[model samples]
Target: MSLNEWFERGISKEEYIDSLQKHRDNFLHIYENFSVPTSDSLSNKENIRTIVLAEEWCGHCMLNIPILLRLTEQANIPIRFLPRDENLELMDQYTVDGKRYIPIVIFIDQEGNEVAKWGPMAPEVKELVEKLKVNVPTKDSPDYEGAFRQYVKEIVDVFRHDAAYWNYVYEDMIKSLP
Candidate 1:
């Protein structure tokens, strides 16, 4: 199917948020409090729509999707949510290193041609995640699973409450727009 057809199949923001189980509160928290910075660059955008490839269970998606929602809402752009697992046909096109990533937001023109895309993490956020991963033990180590879970928890905790990280995501997303 074409990108436009895939986008048409996506759920609305209300449906997507309502269906969220794991990060519904986190999503709400961000949406309620975060504000998009004024951007002349975003002011004149016309005939643009955004499609988000995400899964509710993904921590990265949990962190990024809400911000995107707030951004698109403020910018007056139409946005749709396409669950990553159910829509791998489209996700497959946006893979990194042959692996899929969640919370990839694509901006498409009226013709459904991609203008730009943002995903997975802001550069600063990615650096922080890499730093956090440095201490996780290998699979052979007995503490590996526990350590990894702890790392995930730590990242989510930061992602949920840190305005700096949220700003990083917002700024990067703004840079990604047409």
Candidate 2:
């Protein structure tokens, strides 16, 4: 089946929005006061299909999907969703170092050839992740678990209140699309 059919078979759009609205207050802040684009180049967006592969419970996915839902809705873009876990065969193709990552969006033309793909995060935030990764204890370390949890918490906290940070992300996302 096509990806759109797969998406419709999986989750209703309303359910997706409801899930987004229920995100933790901190993560929810990423969408607050986001200025939805009032105009977009129609010719550039025409006949493009966007598929968002994500997990409902992921904090990053929670922070990003609402903004996508709003902006794409306004732009009249035909976007769909697929759960990463449910599409392992397809999902495996997108892994980084053999580990699956959520919120990876695949963009395609009308004939289904890929145009461009963008996800994970914008450049600046990715730099932060790299910096944070360096401080995490290795698996062989006795303090691995605590250190890892602390790192995860720090990333989540960054996503919570970083409005200027998210602006760069949103702008990059819009620019990356076909």
TM-score of each: 0.94, 0.80
- Clashing residue pairs for model 2: none
**lDDT tens readout by residue for model 2, 13-101:** 56555555435465446555555656654355767777788877786686676667666666677777777888877677778667887
After superposition on all CA atoms, what RMSD does each candidate show versus the true structure?
Answer: 1.4, 2.9
TM-score computed on alpha carbons, candidate 1: 0.94
Model 2 TM-score, 2 decimals: 0.80
| Pairs in steric clash, model 1 | none
Score candidate 2 by lDDT. Answer: 0.71
As a whole number from 0 to 100, the lDDT of residue 115 in candidate 2 is 83
- Quality of model 1 by C-alpha lDDT: 0.87
All models: lDDT? 0.87, 0.71
What does candidate 2 score in Cα RMSD to the true structure? Answer: 2.9
